[model samples]
Target chain A: MALCNYYRKRKLMDNLVGWWIRLMVFLVVALPLFITASLLSKSWLILGHISLPELLFSSVWRPLAGEFGFWPFIISSLWVTFIGLSLTAPVCLLSAIFLTYYGSRRLLGFMQPIIDILAGIPSVIYGVWGILVIVPAVGKYLAPMLGYESPGFSIMAGGIVLSVMLIPFVLNILIEIFRTVQHDLLDASLSLGASKWQTIKHVVLRKSFAGMISAFGLGLSRAFGETIAVLMVVGNVVGVPENLFQPGYPLPALIANNYGEMLSIPMFDSALMFAALLLMVVVVVFNMISRRTIIYLESRQ
Target chain B: MAMETTKLSIQNLNLWFGKQKILNNINIDIPENKVTVILGPSGCGKTTLMKTMNRLVDLQGGARTSGKIILDGEDILNTRRDIALVRQKMGLLSQRPTPLPMSIFNNVAYGLRLKGIRGRKKLTPLVEKHLIEANLWDEVRDRLHDPASRLSIGQQQRLCLARGLAVDPEIILADEPTSALDPISASVIENQFFKLKENYTILLVTHIMRQARRIADKVVFMYLGEVIEQADVHEFFNNPKQKMTRDYLQGAFY
Candidate 1:
């Protein structure tokens, strides 16, 4: 009977241990997301309760007056992302194609480490560098070229700086895609009388289109959500600036610049949270687009 | 069938990879409108020799060759257009296929497109004719629009054969085409070779002695990048002259 009791106790202890492990696993995987979910739900509630027209047309973000329209910031953010992807994807893709097809293996061995180092550098470092170098350089003559009277902090500067930062990421992703193309497939195309460039265009690029699309999609998200660099380079003003050199404030910039000062205004703080929610949506949509591309690639095979 | 007679002759051929002589003093003739099987052990420079025939080996930077590969009495090494023409006239399928990620029709049409044959009306009939000649039309006729990769391994091998034939090459070089297929599929491909012999000159490379015996009209038995013996297929199999060829035929090659 005493032996039976001991076995029973041991089994009970094992069950307790298993429950403890489950709890630990749940905490590790589920906690941060729990907090994020809570925050998201609260933002949705705030969005549901917010007064109408103030969310749309109003540009003045004076919390006391209850005028809050995020359109200008949204436009600026989208405009910057568009400009950045356009400039970055082409240059980076071309470089990657060059590196894969034209560049020697020796040159690739030399350039890869530099690209990695550039990838690891923080956004703040890019921002500080942009402020010190790009702002002054572009401001000198770009103001006239953009047809603006005077360039202060400019969208064009931010877009260009952001483009520079995005280059390495795009190049690395493209290189990885290019490298994954099968050598046999490449040989097959070339031996069939296609030229070297023709093989790259038809076989390598066509095969890697899904991966390339995903890489650019990820890069666009990064460029869109970029905060510190754009803040440093863009002249923060709340109107649609036709001139590229004109001052603009993206959504993240507004949240970053105003969240600390939004102490007294309850709706204002929630409005910033709403902007966070919108940014999350942007990231989610890009990821979905990338996922679709991946699915298409798998189906193609 | 309607036009020209072409032939391949290699004289005093030698190949080197960065001072390591892979093929030495190689000289041979592969006849036009015949099934020539090259029999050799692994690393005997059989693949290297096969690649050298169509100038595929020329793309390698440090791998050098000194030889005269005369196609139809013209030295191919002396001219770029000649090399291109040689490659265009010859279709090569490697030991393993390298099918493009495409529909069955596109994979066949790939070479045709490169040859500047456009317009659906022109391309469609050519694709069907080649597929029919390759013995793949019956299986794929209804599903020609499907991805080529969806086919079974046996079907893929035949599809590759169709792809090779689409370019209308007089010579077809298959480096172990059926090595990856099952016995049934291998036999199927081997049977297709007999039918193909009426049109295309075939240079087949395989480690399988049985396969070479079954299909080869002329056997060029090579060991270590050197031709041990050349004879009619019956003589090479039933009465091999070289001791090495006899050993290789009996699976005693080391």
Candidate 2:
């Protein structure tokens, strides 16, 4: 009777644990759907008022006059992300390669804490740093150097700040990717008379091509959604940027800047919700496409 | 047997990994155009000694070495010549075949390209010739553009051999090249070594006594990071000077 009771209790405990695990898994899958559905329902108010094409393509974002065109914000988001990625990719990749291949143990040890601290810093702090350092440099030094006269707050400032913020994040992933290449493969290449640079170019880079793409893709998504730092330096102008030097407003900045005061306006809250929904959808779609590309590359290999 | 010209001579070679001494005062003369087998049990520093010859041991952190490795009248250990030049003179075959992450033809052409040979017309014949020399031409001739990773273990090993040979090295350093293969594949590699020794000096590292007897013209026996005996293969087997060598030959202990 005692043995039978022990077995029954054990079975009951196992059943309880199994149910808990299943519930956790279901929640993970359902949470995203729930958020998306709520966002869709909230944004439908404005979507019903105007078609998405007109809302996305028109740039006249007059909140008081009741027009909510998202074209300027979308373009600003793309330009900032593009400039950030362009600056970040090459610098981070080269740093990762140098650290992995030629860095001494002591040098690596020294760099580890610095990189951790960089990655741990808040975006608000970065914005402050940009305001203090990058803004003046752009306005006083860079504008004259480039033969332009304007306030420092522009898309260029946002891109430079975003690139600095993203360096450690992208670099950490790339270092791991480069390190994942087999040591024996390196040995084989070295023994074959290839120099260290040659081996890295032919073997390490080739082997980690898929990983590099995914790392860049992740960097892209992160850059696309970065809010405070970009907003602080981007001048928050509601227009399409004429050039890299022009002031522009991105989607996240718009949503964050207007969410509190949006309740009084008729469709203002719905428009802000639409902006959030758009950001979420773009990030999700980009992640899906990169994931598919990675899977395809790995299978072909 | 007639004495052959000395191709490489190692004198007073000692190596250390941190505080642990790995190769202790090693000395050996490798003859040209001959299969010189370094026969030893595991952890006897056979592979380390070979790695030192090509200076691949420099890659290991905390590794310290004092040695004089003379290759073709040049002191490889202390020479001002480029390390790449030193490595280019010797082709090393590791235990497992590690094909470069590329198509079959490209794996062979990689070395050729490094030597400044470009264009398909120049590379195709050379790649084909090396593949033929490695005895893999028939199996892979149809799929030269297929990824080298898709090849079987045996075929990949041959591809590595072809890649090594494409660089036209004077010496072939094969560290248990057949150890990862099946018996049939092992025999095929052994046959290739026998034929290859006519043109290139081969230094083979192995623990298998039967394999040493089969392929070795000159044998150097090692124990606990020291060279115990060195002689012609027959004499080394039949009349070992060291008691350890005699015991090892009789299968007393590994």
Candidate 3:
């Protein structure tokens, strides 16, 4: 009887462990789908209802006449992402250099909390802050000096906010990449008569090239998809204006605004879903390229 | 007497990393054109002593030092700029094989480029000569443009030597240059050290006694942050004066 009881308890314990692992796996795989089910399902339903040709070439984004062409949004978004990454890349790259090369223990210890705080700041908060602070600062003061009429809540504001949001992300990734460079290689380069700057140029950057590309791609993708911050400051104009001071709209904002209204105009809603699908493809391509680069680098090493 | 000779001298040297003392009253004379081997057990201040000669250990946080180290009659701790120049003057090869992540040619040419030599024709032959001296030329000369990291462990160590020599350093400081290699490669490295000493003063720290017997002109025995014995290789092996040295020689501690 005692032997049978011991075997029964052992089986129970093994079953408990197995059940616990299954629960963990369920949480890992099911949580994201559960949370985003409404949005995804809505997009899918709209996608199924729309005809093929109308979804393919419709770029007009006129909400009043029900003609919502998405070309202007695409153009504006591409430019914003380009400008945001261009601004973020150099500053974040330089910051990563400072963190890795010049930082003492005390300096890094002090910077940790600041980076955490920046990383925790909400996108909407950045949007509101950018509108209140940057728009006027650039519009009333900096714009007049630069000979521009009105540098309003347009590309300039959106780009600045997007850049700020991407800084912490880029910084975090780059800091790790920079830290992974071996000290022996650093010493090897230094003892070889390479000056500090020369070492940075030749060995430091050379070793981290793939990782840097991955980080920059991630930052670019974030800027491209950034919605709340861009929406709050972008002034939500439909047509592409010629200058930086004019209002604009991008894909994420268009999707967010029209996802609810698509119930009334199912056709327009399907068109929006198709837009989401297109943007997803773009991001997927970026991610694939980044992964390929990282994998290629790993294979070389 | 000191003006025209004597590459470096250490007198009454003591080093401490914070509260933990690592080197105790070390004294030695590093002669020019000869290879000196320092043999010790683990945590015996041998590596610390090598790093101190070029002031590499001095920059690490909380590391403190006393006494004097003179390189060609100048105090090592007098200034930072001069210390850097001395560090540049002494090419350092760590225990592991460390080549720059570059082409075989660039690995050797890296130092030359730092000195502001940009001409390809000039850099190429100089690199070829140093690689030949390092005993890696015949194997790698055909693929100088290929990455240096693709070479085997022994080949990488030789490439490191070529890089060090390319800098034209007056002295070479090696901290266990062959502890990472196989026996045959280790012997090959020992041979290169013999050839290299004709031009550069070589100070090597080794845990291998046989290697020291084969290559070292002078041997310094260290234990527990102190130098227990210093003598010519033959003398130290045949007749160690101190009791601790005798015990170490008998392989009791190892």
C-alpha lDDT of candidate 2 relative to the true structure? 0.92
lDDT of 3 at A80: 79
The alpha-carbon RMSD over the true interface for every model, in angstroms, is: 1.5, 1.0, 2.0
Candidate 3 lDDT by residue in tens digits, A194-301:
666777889889899889999998998888898999988877777776777677788888888767774675356656766676677678688889999888875554
lDDT of 3 by residue, B105-163 (tens): 98888888877788998898899899999899999978888877789999999989888
Model 3, position A11: C-alpha lDDT score:
100
Best by lDDT: 2
Return the TM-score for chain B, candidate 3. Answer: 0.95
Q: Candidate 3: which docking quality band? A: medium
DockQ score of the complex predicted as candidate 1: 0.53
1 versus 2: better TM-score goes to = 2
Clashing pairs in 1: A153-A235
Each candidate: what lDDT?
Answer: 0.83, 0.92, 0.82
For A1-301, candidate 2 gives per-residue lDDT tens digits of 9999999999999999999999999999999999999999999999999899989999888877889899999999999999999999999999999988888767777887899899999999999999999888888898779988758898889999999999999998998898899888998899888999999999999899899989999999999999999999988998998877878899999988978885898899999999999999999998999999899777655
Clashing pairs in 3: A59-A69, A59-A70, A60-A68, A60-A69, A61-A68, A61-A69
